[model samples]
Target: MILRMAWRNIWRNKLRSITIMMAVALGLTAGVFASAMINGMMQSRFHEFIENQISHLQLHHPDFVGQQEVYQHTGVPRDQLDRVLENPMVRAATVRTKVHSMIASATYTGGVELMGVLPENEKQTTGFHNNVVEGNYLEKHGTNEILLGSALAEKMRVQVGSRVVLTFQDVDHNMVSAAFLVTGLYETGYTRYDESFALVHMDYLNNQINIGNSFHEMALLLTDIDHIPAMTKELEVMFPGLHVRAWNEVSPEMSVLVEAGDVFAYIFLVIILLGLAFGLLNTMLMAVYERTREIGMMMAIGMNKQRIFALILFETLALSLVGGVFGIVGSWAIVSWVSRVGIDLSAFDDVMKEIGFSPVIYPVLETAFFITLILFVMLTALIASIYPSLRAMRLNPAESAKR
Candidate 1:
């Protein structure tokens, strides 16, 4: 009976009821879309950073992570690497030999970390070619040519086909220098990488360091991201002498950004929810004022205060449900369309790249985020009705009748 009365009463002032519903719907739409877009962009950026820049996991000698400079002292053998890669969780693996060196040119000289990679295996495992900004990737099983980061090339005032001398301390602690032709230049948008790293053929390093079949570290690419922690655990148990670390573990900056983004998204969701709750409160408060006499008549006619309160609560709940349903459907349609087309940030490409971010991002609409958002909006509406419902229940029959 109370529900029927409340439903009828809402239609008595259709304009006001609809206005309130629109407010709730708009709030829901904004909250859902904004949260979904932000989360999607963040995930995309993190994934790209991990895939293009950092492989999923890395294996280092037990003491190498701390004493990375002493590559000769802490080298992982080929036999041990073969055993680790036997795990099905490991999708691809590559060996890396790193040495700090000074890259010198006629016009410039700067410190750089020389990364020796197997051209064929590195290309297949790391997609290194896709990141090349100019020229081509290093040839397999070749020497006398090298790839320089774009920033490093610019600093050196050298272009493709130019010659640069790379000087470094060999495994015997003796200075070894070699001059190689610059084959290509690549930009990863990260200042540190672009300014301080060079790629060389792995065999070149072996010859320079006089080491055969040895690597400073092993980088692994995983098929699925969720398997990282599990694979890390398995590697730790199987290879107790090696240290396993994820991409995020190796770089604290990326981890911090991911954590901060999650907190920001939650804060935005809460703020939108609070705004929707206030809108509901306003609507319910106005309903109480307009239906003062009606509520009093119900009290006089044997409807107890509990039923009166239930009536108002039911009205608020129905309004929220109707708005929530519409919001979900409407927001979903918008999100789907936008996700397919994508939001372009090309105008800010240079700025974004300068800050180490990708400009283009496509948001993903997850059903879980939508469902949770709807439930939270509905809960807010229900909670907002408590005070107004209590006010309606406290109305005096005589005073309301006189008014």
Candidate 2:
């Protein structure tokens, strides 16, 4: 059969065939590794964003999202918070008052998103306690204790026990400034969060502003993010007056990221595949040129041009198939091992943290990538074989024997 002939011809020059296989394998391995690394980094950023900033869902005053003014409190009574918590999918929830305000230390004044939180509840809602780099989380019944992010602290040159003035407009648009003692310095590893956000006790903002029985925002944690859609609808129906939204709705940039990541992976795959395709074309072309005399002999003995073309394509496909297997399986083994150990990126921590990324990355490649890459390699093989196969088909039995 033509298939068996093509298989046998490959072994006639085993060294050359093996060399091409190695080249394909190595090229694809590098591609897969790079793709996995990028995916891992993106995954880490999203995980951190969800864990530290956007809890799973949020409930806010309908007008709060529009203007975010001081007076746009969640109109829902405080006691109804229990009704939202009663859902089985709800893990934890916390209410907060937010104001874009300025925190002034002795000689520094910096803008910050001042958050009034119930410390213990917030721990369950957003992992705030674990992010604390210095000092403990807020006390249960604290008056004016504040938590400062490391970047904010550095910008203000303020440390623990430093008294800072927080000046913002109250609900009535009256300018009110309150003094808060910095009880803790927290570092969320996200420089933007650190540079612009600080935490304080909710009671201070509520009583100080005289917004009794009301909160501006409520953040929720779910048993799993998959439950967000269902929970959002449930809560929206329950608190019809409040604007309930999932994390993605709250952060459209992250929503776009989650959707567009696959496009990025495919682009990387195409670039690498093109590189491999050139190498494959060169290798296959050499195989055809070296086998010109043999190809002529076969044609003289009655093998047709179509059979010769088929033979060359089959050989190229076999070469690519073997290499594709090695590349996919081997890359997966490498990525799995590294995922456990993690690739230390401490050298680039400062730059990475500025982008809200973690220093260490654990490479991860989905099983789908292997299938896609294997098919892509097959397509590359098909394209690479065309020119060389045509060259073999054009060979003259009498003329090819001379050289």
Candidate 3:
């Protein structure tokens, strides 16, 4: 009976009721959609770094991790790699000889982190070959072949088949210079990364540095990301001498940024809801003021104050819930359609790439987020109903009945 009365009371002023409902719906839709877009951008950037660049876990010599010394190889035998590969959770693994070196073309020179990797293993682990936008990936038997990032190529004014000079200290700390053919130019849409890294054939680099088949880094991609913590511990136990680190440990800033994005999304939604709460408060207060005479008549007819407060509370909740349902359904439909098609910010392509974000964004929201949103709406309605319900209960029956 109370619910039916509450539902019917809101429609007594149809214009005001519909106006508040539409306001709530529009505010929630905008807030949820904005949150979804931010989520999508953060997820895209994080996965791009993890899957295509960093992998899930890495193994390195203690000195190599600390100082990046070329001679600080993992010192583990090749059989150790075979053992790691035998693990069921390790989906793919590759070893690389990493060095900080200067790469120079005829026109320009720049610093690069040169990674010498087995082409097939590297491809399986990082799928870097898929990013080759121009020319071919390193050939299986290719010697002295190098793949330069597209940004690096542009900065160096080099192209496919261009001869470039690589200069670095060999394992002995002796400066060594060699010529490498640029077999490919790849772009991962992370401009800073593209400008800072290059790849070469492992055997060729090993012979050049006089480090026979030794590698400084071992990167691994796991079958499931949820296994990262367990796998990191397992690898540590297996290779007690080598330093094993998860992707988050390697890049703490990215992890922090992803977490901050989630917090910011909720904060933003709360700010919007607060605004809606004020709107709800104003509307309910006015409704209470206008219906004073009606409420007084009920009170005179023996309706108790507690029931009167509950009626007002129920009316506020009903108004909010009806609006919330419409808003959630509308936001879901918009998010679903937008996620499928994606929102292109091609106009900001260069800036987006420079900052390690994709130009295209696909909005997404978890089911749990919608559930929480409903709870938030209910809470807001309850808080907004408080003052108005108190005012309704405080009215004098004789005076209100006369008015």
Q: Who wins the TM-score comparison?
A: 3
Cα lDDT tens digits for candidate 2, 124-221: 87888898888878885758999999888988888998899989888899899999998899988788878888998888878777687688888888
Ranking by TM-score: 3, 2, 1
Model 2 clash pairs are none
Global CA lDDT computed for model 1: 0.81
lDDT of 2 at 159: 90
Better of 2 and 3 by TM-score: 3
TM-score of each: 0.93, 0.94, 0.97
User: lDDT (CA) for every model shown?
Assistant: 0.81, 0.86, 0.91
Candidate 2 has an lDDT of 0.86
Candidate 1 residue 236 C-alpha distance from true site, Å: 3.1
Model 3 accuracy (lDDT, Cα): 0.91
Better of 1 and 2 by lDDT: 2
Off by over 4 Å in 1: none
Q: What is the lDDT of residue 332 in candidate 1?
A: 89
Model 1 — which ten-residue stretch has the worst lDDT?
70-79
